[model samples]
Target: MTVYRIPAAYLHQIEQELDSDEKETMLFLCQDLVPDLPVPDVRKLLLALNAREMLTPVSLSELLYRMKRFDLLKKVLGIGRAAVEANLATCPQMVSKYRVLMTEINEDLDKDDLTSLVFLLMNDLGMSHVKMAKDKSFLSVITDLEKLDLVSPNRLDLLESCFLNIHRKDLAKKIQKYNWEAPVHPIGSSLKYVNTLQASFPKLSLADPPGIVNKGRLKNGACNFQTEQLRMAIPETGGALGQVSNKYRMQSQPLGVCLIIDCIGNDAGMVARTFKALRFEVRCHLFLNVDSMMRELYEVARLRQHKNYDCFVCVLVSRGDHQGIFCTDHIIPGFSLERLKSFFIGDRCPDLLGKPKLFFIQNYIEASNHQETPSLVEADGGLCTIPQVADILWSQSKVDASTLDRSPNSSSYYLTTLSELLMDPHKRTLPLLDILVELNHKVYEWNRTNPAEPHSLLLEHTLRKKLFLSGT
Candidate 1:
C-alpha cells in the first residue's frame, strides 16, 4: 500500500491527542477550507480516514490540531470555536458556501466597481434588503470611494442639486475652490453695479421696485413751482437705494436675484451702462405703473422664504406732477419692518449699510439753469443765478393736509390732469428728451391759454432758462 505524506507541520499537530467526533468534524471543515483544491485529493483524505475507522474523540482532536497548525481552522469554521458548532447546528454546507462567496467577492471588487455595486444595491435593492445590509446604508460611501484628484468642473450642477436636496451646508464652504466671491465694481462707470452683481451671483434674491399708488398722479403731478422735492426725488432715490439693497443681497451669495424697473421712460441705455460698470447680472421685470410693481413685489415677498427679498427699487419718474407711493398701508397693510430688516440682515455679513445708497438726485432736483452773465468789472467773473427749483416747487404746492384728505380730483386738478396725460400711451411713446421739449411747449401753450395759475408762467421761464443754459 502506498502512503501519502501530509506537510510536516500538519503531521506534527495530528500526532497530538484528539477525540473521534472532533477528528471527523475537523476533517469536514478542512475540506471546506481548501477552496480550489482538486476534488480527488479531498476524496482521498476522506477515504483514508474512513478506511481507518479511527474517528474517535482523540483522533478528531488530532485532526483539529492539524487544521489549527496550518492556520485553516478560522477560515473553515468561522471565527470562534463555538462558530463551528453554530455552523453545524444550521445548514453547515450553506455556511461554508457563504464564506467562500464572501472571500471571492472581496478579492474581485476594485474601488470603482465596489462603489457602483454599492449604488446598485442601495438604489435598486428593496427597502427590506437595504435595512439588512450593513454596508449599503450611506449613499456618500460610494462617492468617497470614487472622488477624483482634480476638481471636476462638469459635476458642479450635479453637486449643487445633490447638496441642495440633501441639505448639505458644507457645499457652500467648498465655494472657495471655484473663486466665487464678489468682485469690486468699476469706478466712474455708468453701468448699474446691482445688475452686474445679479448676473454674477445667480443665487441671490433682490428686492422689487417700490410700488406706485397713483401712476397718473406720479406722471403728471406738477412741473411748475408746486411739487415736493422729496416726492420728486423719491422715485429716482428709491431706484438707487433698491440697487444698493440688491448689491447687499448678492454679496451674501443666495440662490437668485430679481430686479424690478417701474418707469415710463427710463434711460435703459444709461441703466445698461451703469450695470455693466458694476458687473451686475440682472434680469429686469419692467412695470409701467406703481400698482403692478407693488403687487409683484408683495407677491414675491409673501411667497418666498422669510430671508428672501421682496421690495427692491421702485423707479418712479415724474415728468409732470405726481409722486409714487411705493409702500402703502392698503397694499401691504401691517407689513413688518422686522421682516424688511431680516431681508437685509439674514446673512452673516450684512451688506446694506453705510454705502452709497443714493445717487444722481442733483440733476433732477436742481434748477436746470446756470449761466454766466456779463461781468460788472473787468476783474470780476460773470454773475450766475442758481435757483433751487425743486425746493421752490415743493414749497409752493397748494395740497395741504386738508387737500390730501380730499379726493385726487379735488387736490391740484391741473397736476392731476398732467399726470393723466403723461400716463397715456401716446405721451409715453415720445423719447425722454423729446418729452421734456414737448412738456416745455405744452407749458408755454398752457400759460397762453390759462391765466388763473401764474405759477405756469414761472415754470415756463425756469424751464426755458434751464434749457437755454444747459444748451439741451
Candidate 2:
C-alpha cells in the first residue's frame, strides 16, 4: 500500500490552479511521496498550492535533499523531550571528576562573574584537597569543563557537593538555594529581587511581552512562526545563528554598540575609532553640559528602536563613584546601573528579550553601588527584572590610589585592550570569557610592569551562553 502524508483535499484544491510546466515540476518532486498520484499530477498540485502561498519556495526540495539536516533527531529519540531540551554539557558525575584543579582559580584575577564562579568552585570549596585532586586524569576533565557554553543545574549540583564535602556548610547552602533562572539582583544588592512584578501585570510571560509584532502588521511569512519557530530559535553556541533559526536566512542580526562618553576631559574619537575598527557600528553621544537623565532617555529610546540586534554594547565613560555616574553638567541626580538595565527589559523593550546586553563603565569616584530600584520597576503593574535576563554583562574600570602597582593609562586601557582582543584574528573565535581572560592577562602584565598609578578592570557577566563575535 503506497501512502502519502499530505491531505487528499489539499492536493485537489491546489492541482486545479497550476500551469502545465510548474505542475510537471511538482509531480517530479513528489514522485516518492505519493504512489497513488502520478509525478506529473503531483507537480500540478504543488504549483497550484504555491500560487496561493501555501508552501514555501524550494521548501520541498530542501526537505527531500536535506532529510538529515535535523541534527537533533537522534538526541530527541535517545532521551525524552526534557533531556533533549536541557541545554547542558556533560553530566554531574562527569563534572565531579574535574574538581582536582579547583584550587588554581585565582581570586585576585579581576574578571567576570564566570571567573569568580570558578574561584568559588576551586579555592573556597577546596576541591583540590579531595582524594584524586592531583591526578592527571582529573585535571584533564577540568580542562573540558572550562570550555562548556553554559553551566547547567546538574553542574551546579556537582559544585555544591564539593562545597559540602569540604565542610563549608554556608557556601553549600547558598549554592543549593540560589535560583539561576531568576532575575539577576542588582550589583551590590543585599537581597535578591524576585519576579513579583509579574504577579501585578499577569500578562507578560517569558515569551514576547509586547511591541515585538508591531500590532496588526506582523504577518507570518515563510517561517513556521508560532509553531516550529520558537524551538528553532533556541540559542546554540558555536553556530552562526545564535538563537536565530535557519528559516530566516535572509534576515541578519546587526552589530551595534552605544558609547555614552561624558567628554569633559576625555577623548571620544579614540574610543569611537577603536570600536569602528572592530566592525561595531558605534553611536557616540557626548554629554558636555546636558542633563544626565536626558542621555539615559536617549539610550532607552535607541535600545527600543534597535531591539533586533543580536548583541547590545553600552559603554558609559563618565565621572563619579561606585554608586552612580555623574554627567559633565554636575547634576544632583545621576544614573544607576540597575535603572539603566530596567529600560531595556522585556516589559519595556520586548523585541530584545533574549539577546545579550553588555555594559562597560569607567568611573571617576568611590561611592556606594547599593541596589536602587528604579521608579519604572516599582510602578503599578511594572515588570520585575530577572537574573540571566538576556545575558547581561558588566565591566567596570577600578583604579586604586593605594596600591603601588596602580598606574593609569592616558587613554582607556580596558577599552583599547578589549577592542584589540575582539578583533584579534587568531583569538576572535573564542568565547567572551576567553577574550576577557586574555584582557585580564594583558592588564595584569601592564600594571606589573608600569606601576605608576595602578589600574584594574572589574569584569562581571551573567550571560548564559558562549558569545562569539565573528567578523563583526
Candidate 3:
C-alpha cells in the first residue's frame, strides 16, 4: 500500500489563507506537539506534524475545526463541521486546554486592554517584566507568565481577577468556564502526549558524531588555527578608567582575547566571527582531548601576547555533567569548571589581574543519575580573606545531548541566540551584564515558542563593576 503524504502545494494554500495573528495562534496551539520550529510558518509546522504522524487527515480537520477555520476544513480536507463534531469522541485534541484558554484570553485583549493589564500588574511584576510587557506582544507576555509558573492549568484566579480589573468580565468568563468544565480524557488515543513528558532540557549524549573528530586520535584533531589573529584597533575615548565611574575600565585596543574551544565543530565559526566582530582577537580550537584542553587553556591564561588586552573571554562547547565538561574521549566525569576558572585567577595568571575574565560555557549536560558531592570549607585561621574568584563572570548553559544527535550540524538554541544578540550593533554600547539579561529574555522567548527544546542560562559572577565590551 502506498503511504499518504501531505502535498507541499496544499500546505502552501493553507498558509496563504492564514493571517499573521492566525499563524501565531496556530503555532502557540501546536507548540506542545511540534516544538523548536520557527514561528509564523504555518506550512512548515503542518508539514512537521504530518511527518511525525501526529496529525492525520482526521486530526488535521479537527485542529482547523477548533481554530474555527471551517472554510478550510471543508474546502481543503473535504470534511464538514458536522463530520468533525460526530468524530470528536474518536479524535484526540492536540492542543492543550491550558494553551487554548490563554490564547482565547489574548484574543480578547486589545492594545488598551493589554496596556491596562500591564499597568494593573505593575507592582506585581518585576522591573524587567515591565519592560518586556511594554516591548513585546501580549501573547509573549502570557508565555513569560507560564514560564514563571504564574499561570497554569489549575490556576486561573490571577488571570480572571486581572480581566475583571480591566472591565472585561466577558473575558473573565472564559477563564471561569475553563475552570468549571471538567476535562475528558481521550481513551486509547494513539498520539500520546509524549513530548510533554520528555526532559525540559536537552541531555548531552556520550557518543561523538562521525567525521567531526576521532576520540582516540587526539594528535590528529582538527583545529581552525588563526595564523594572524584579527583585532579591531579603535582608539580609546573615555578616561583610562572607562567613562562611567562604576563601569569596569575597558580602554585597551583589541578589547580581549576570545578563545573558542569547540568540541562539536558545528557552531565554532559562527561564534568566532561574532566575538571577532565585537573587536576582540578571536582564536578557535576544536576536538581536543583532556591533555590538549588543559595545555591550551594554560597557554591562554599565561600568554604575554594578551597582557595589554582589556579582558579575557573563553567560549567552551562540549558535553558535560554536574561535575564538568567532557573531552573527546567521552570520559565518565569531565573536567571541572572550577579548575578551568582556577587557571585564570590572579594567583595563577597575573597578566589578567584587575581585568574582567569572562567565560561563556555551552555544555550539553549528559542525562544520568550522577549526584554532586557537597564540599565543606575549612578555615585556615586567617583573620581576613580576599575572594580569589573576583573579576570573573561565568555564563553557562546546558542543553540536551540529543539536540546534537538530531542535527549534527545545527547549533544549540542558546549559542545561536547568544551570537545573534552579541552581533547586534544597537547592543554594542550596552554592558555585558545587561546583554546577558537580554540573552535570558531571548531564551525565555525561544522556550515559549519552542517547548520541545528549552535552553537555560546560568550566570555566576564576582565582578565589582559593569563590563562594556564595545564602544571602549
Each model's number of backbone clashes?
A: 51, 18, 6
CA lDDT, candidate 3, residue 245: 57
Misplaced by over 4 Å in model 2 are: 1-253, 264-267, 288-293, 299-305, 331-333, 366-388, 400-409
Error of 1 at 179 (Å): 44
lDDT of 1: 0.29
Q: Over the stretch 1-472, how does candidate 1's per-residue lDDT look in tens digits?
A: 3433333344334434334433433434444233334552434454444344323232333344334432344432224555444534441121122122222233334555544444344543445544554453222232232242111221222232233333342442342223233222211111111100111111211121232212111112121122222221221111353453212122222222233242323333344333333333333453333334433433333333323321122222222121212222122121221121122221211222221111111001112233222111111111111121211111111112232333322323333333344455565444323444454455445545643332221121111111110111
Off by over 4 Å in 3: 1-244, 370-388
Ranking by lDDT: 3, 2, 1
- Candidate 3's displacement at residue 285, Å, is 0.2
Question: Candidate 2 on 1-472: residue-level lDDT in tens?
Answer: 3322344444454445445533443343333233244334564545443443333312332322222223322322222334322422221111111121232221211234334344444643356532233332322234334334112212343444444444444554554334232333222222211110011111223355332321111133211223222122333322455454322111233455555554433546666765566556677767644233443443454454454455666777666545455666544344444555655654344455556667766655533453332111111121223333445766666553133123333556656777778767777777777887777778777777766544546666656566666632
Give lDDT: candidate 2, residue 128: 51
User: All candidates' lDDT scores?
Assistant: 0.29, 0.44, 0.68
Better of 2 and 3 by TM-score: 3
